[model samples]
Target: MQTQRNRRGYIQHFINCKHLWLNELKKLAHDLKNPYLLKENVPEYPRPEFHVSHLKHDTERGALCWIRTDGGFKDPHRGFRDPHKWSLVWWSLAVGPEEIKAAETRLLEKTYPNQTKEQAVKQQSFLWRFATSPAFSEKSRYGSYRFTFPLQDVLSAYSQQFCFGAPPIMRVFRTCLFKKKVQYSVLVHSPANRELFSEFPLLPGNDPNAVCAYRDGRFIWRSEAMCETHRY
Candidate 1:
């Protein structure tokens, strides 16, 4: 238990740095935060049979990381392997579920601006139903965080240029899945359901958004906004 606590402390200190934002693994370790970050993961074990938290209670919790795989399908449109890779869905666990619902409403209206009021409202609710479930909220071990983003979702993007300043501002939907075995990493930008860019051969810009990205047109990826971003 002491070892676990110490590890969490080490991770927390490293994650709080903006200078290492470009380091993918460290970036994700930071974004997911602690507690769960310390406990989540069972790569050696297969699906539905992995570790699960036995504890259960009715209370708001922290953000949960939802991971999904794509049967190793090959993407034909890009020169990168990440777009065709696995993804993680960042969903609310116990923290401010109400606020999340409200944000979903706004995103619905923005995404489907031309839809009728009724359609937009329904869409927002629909997104909320699946996106914010408390599946693993009370798990004393692993929560229901094995959520997947579809193949069409561009949750992450690549930037060839390495930025010198702080990391980009992360959105609420953005989360990560750390592959300890590989020690390499990928970021899952849930809004687009794709990587911010591909790793095949990144263009220069230092800015993740400025470089030529696979899913560049989205509003969140458009503005030069980033988090400390949320905690650098």
Candidate 2:
């Protein structure tokens, strides 16, 4: 009886923490203050905007990184293709207050992997996910999963260019995914700094062989190879 009661207590505590984390996450996402320059380039569709938060200044123990996105089926266009089968991805960075604190330490370890001189110095994992439940199981229908690291990881590469004076503003990288002879499109999220991305190739506008599209969207890529790696 005592063990059963302890188990019930633990589960309740987990549920409470989850609720608190999610509430804080939503507040951070909707509190947009700056003008998002990249939103104007994309085709206006009702897609969920992804968010990240860091209470690095806070003394609180349960600070977290929250992500809102869709999982499986390759990309966002797949979700649009089958709205009824779309799955929402949501999860806290850590399971409990103790783990939440450890998560920050893990972030440091992830960012600077050369800390331990004994091990092979290399880039640690990026674009990784962790979940409190078995939602990502092979046969499961649930699709909630959260990226384990903060949004800073995504902005780190263009840190010098995009984040020198102010917090980097994320923009969309319009992408064309060609898989199984069917072409689909979705916005690739990135910092809005044009200098870093302007030189790279973009998906052609109207004409696949257009020499240079002047009024066309800024940064684009026909991700044919990328599409082969995942299901459409």
TM-score list, all predictions: 0.25, 0.19
User: Any idea how many clashes model 2 has?
Assistant: 0
lDDT of 2: 0.27
Q: Give all candidates' CA lDDT scores.
A: 0.29, 0.27
Residues 32-105 of candidate 1: C-alpha lDDT, one tens digit per residue: 55333344331321011111111122212232311114322222323332233433322222223443355456
- lDDT tens string, model 2, 99-213? 3234434555666566775442343422122312221122222222223434344335335544563444322222211112111222122345445544444434454333212
Return the top candidate by TM-score: 1
Q: What are the RMSD figures for all models against the true structure? A: 19.5, 22.4
Error of 1 at 70 (Å): 50
To one decimal, what is the Cα RMSD in angstroms of model 1 from the true structure? Answer: 19.5
Q: What is the lDDT of residue 158 in candidate 2?
A: 34
CA deviation > 4 Å runs, candidate 2: 1-147, 152-162, 178-232
